[model samples]
Target chain A: MTVSLEQARIIIAQTFKKGSELGLKPLSVVVLDAGGHVQAFEREDGAAPGRFAIAHGKAYGAVMLGMAGRAQMARAEAQAYFMSAVNGAFGGAVVPVPGGILLRDDQDAVIGAVGITGDTSDNDVLAGLAGIAAAGLKAEA
Target chain B: MTVSLEQARIIIAQTFKKGSELGLKPLSVVVLDAGGHVQAFEREDGAAPGRFAIAHGKAYGAVMLGMAGRAQMARAEAQAYFMSAVNGAFGGAVVPVPGGILLRDDQDAVIGAVGITGDTSDNDVLAGLAGIAAAGLKAEA
Candidate 1:
């Protein structure tokens, strides 16, 4: 099933809330449907202007490639040209970072993805996981 | 001055509310800072997958060009090549359409823009106007 608008909003809101609670920098979050289309997005007050696009690219890469962000990063390092070609094909939407997480349904099928920015990649991933858990969804990180 | 994150959220929320009240199709709304960076965006549950990009392009074009959607459309018709060049320059973030509006402060300085899509252009403009009014901001349409 596709992610509803309410679920996307919850994912964004909770992501920011988690970031705040953890004392991370202001965060930018994006939620993308399985088709790699944006469902919802927000950038906190002090986040840099480019954070939104970076978050979007990370989530788009995860949803479109059916891989977790960590895997994408590993592959990018092992096959730089391949990663570049993929990013070019997708109009540069693949960030290949650690902050993108796939959301799974009860059946273990990918339903959507969330990407977070404005902190270290590891910290970003933590916030994403917290948001996914709060939304009652499983995260494939 | 730039549009704050809270103001951007309010604009998107109220835009969707107005669309719902008018019985319009599920809409995609985007808010952009004056620098043409995304502040917030959302696509309603039933909105088309591409609606988010369309809404973003509309708002980006408005903020980048410092013009209302009507003015952009008129210019696009009068100078198609120029419009194409501008879109190319912005990496295709400029959409000449009726749903884009420039948000102005009390002194008539542009602070941001809002864009809506998924309904007829006229109805989209109406919803955007209503949202801007509700947000207590002036719309340069």
Candidate 2:
């Protein structure tokens, strides 16, 4: 399905609610279309200033590299040179980590991504995944 | 010369101040060292949601390609294919416009860049330039 701003917002809103329900610290969340254009975003109170970048970078990095950040971390070790070159080339915009995942529609096409920050990378990833699932979308991995 | 975090903060703060003084909307400012590491950044209230990505991409483009975004726009004329390839490859992170600039310390060596968004592209350029100047840094342009 097409990536709609409404859908993105719904997902993000639900994610924020879940975060609050869990009593996690404030979070910054973003959704991007398959084209990587931002679809929706929300910054909770007290979210760090740079949290937006961290979330975007993780999402963009995952999309660009076609894998989760954790997977990238594993690959980065053996492909250190390649990863470094790209990292250098992208100017810190590309941060490979597990807090991001591609969103797939029922048809299994990559529709978009959800990213969150303001906790451990693992917690961030879990939140992102929850948001995607709550949106009634599926994560391929 | 090292790019101090303080200088980066000053640059971002001034850029937002200048943008607001001119009646521009909230803005996001990015500072990148010559090696393209993030020195600092700030996002103003009501700033366009994704001003963050555009600012970073604009700055990254300037630093990596060794030309301002406007110059990249000009180069895009004869280099359309290359430009498209870049856009295709980077997914929307390659913003080739004039809103970003190279920064140099007194020694005149390219040290880093600053990118701003939340206004017209011209204003974006002006904001970045203002940040650089306010920080007492020079642009190689």
Candidate 3:
């Protein structure tokens, strides 16, 4: 499954709208293509200074490592030292957090990822799923 | 003058569209606010590696110094040692080239800057100007 940049923009917008309407905190959202490169990102006016980097990092880690960020957090618990070294090697481009979600197609193949920030971990995850749905893209199991 | 992330994204998209219409090389465009922080950025498919850095660097320099990149190049010519040392100090975050342009408001206040890459310096400047116009913003004189 491949994701185009236009779809990525739509996903980000939808994520913002849904998150805002739900009374979630201002957010920064990032969408990456299958290759783990940024397609589009948006940070709301009141989003924190580091929100963009965190949001993009989460999506980058999910797409590059082929696992959702929350799953990576679980692994990070057991291999904290190794994960830290690896993250250092990559200049800190990964975030092991619940906001990262893999986007999929009908065939169940991963196509891209979305990362949302500025809300609780659970709410961020919900925002990612909502964005994917708004874009009409499936989510990986 | 202030540049919203929405306007920044629009400017980037317009830059790509105009560059394509002109049959230029693959391009990357970046927009930075008055504080020289990345607001929105995009790298077209097939854009060369480092294109994003160059684009962002150009805009960062423009916003940080409140001058168009061409003016910065003129300064560079007269102060090569100073330019080199400054760039070295900042790890090359400043690109003194023609592609960076300052965005202004009705009062002629500097609000943001846009940097364009992947073509001749002159064409890059033209693309930046067009993008600013497309976003309904005036270019700083």
Which candidate number has the best DockQ? 1
i-RMS, every candidate? Answer: 0.6, 9.3, 2.4
Q: Which ten residues in a row have the lowest lDDT in candidate 3 chain B?
A: B44-53
* Cα lDDT tens digits for candidate 3, A1-141: 467767877788888888877899988887777777766667777666568778888887888888898888888898898768868977888888788889988888888888888999889888778888988998741
lDDT of 2 by residue, B1-141 (tens): 545655776787788778877888777777776766555555554455567678888887777777878788888888988877877776657788778788877876777777777888888777767777888888743
By lDDT, the best candidate is 1
- DockQ comparisons of all candidates to the true complex: 0.87, 0.05, 0.42
Query: Residues A26-59, candidate 1, lDDT per residue (tens digit)?
Result: 9999999988899999999878989888998889
* C-alpha DockQ for predicted model 1: 0.87
CAPRI-style grade of the A/B interface in model 1 = high
Residue pairs in candidate 2 whose N, alpha carbon or C atoms collide under 3 angstroms = A69-A97, B34-B111, B69-B97, B70-B97, B70-B98
Q: Which lDDT value does model 1 have at A137?
A: 94
Q: What tens digits encode model 2's per-residue C-alpha lDDT throughout A28-66?
A: 776767766565555664565567678777777766666
Q: After superposition, how far is residue A76 of candidate 1 from its true place, in Å?
A: 2.2
Model 1's C-alpha root-mean-square deviation from the true structure amounts to 1.2
Model 1 / residue B54 / CA error / Å = 0.7
Chain B only, TM-score of each candidate = 0.96, 0.89, 0.93
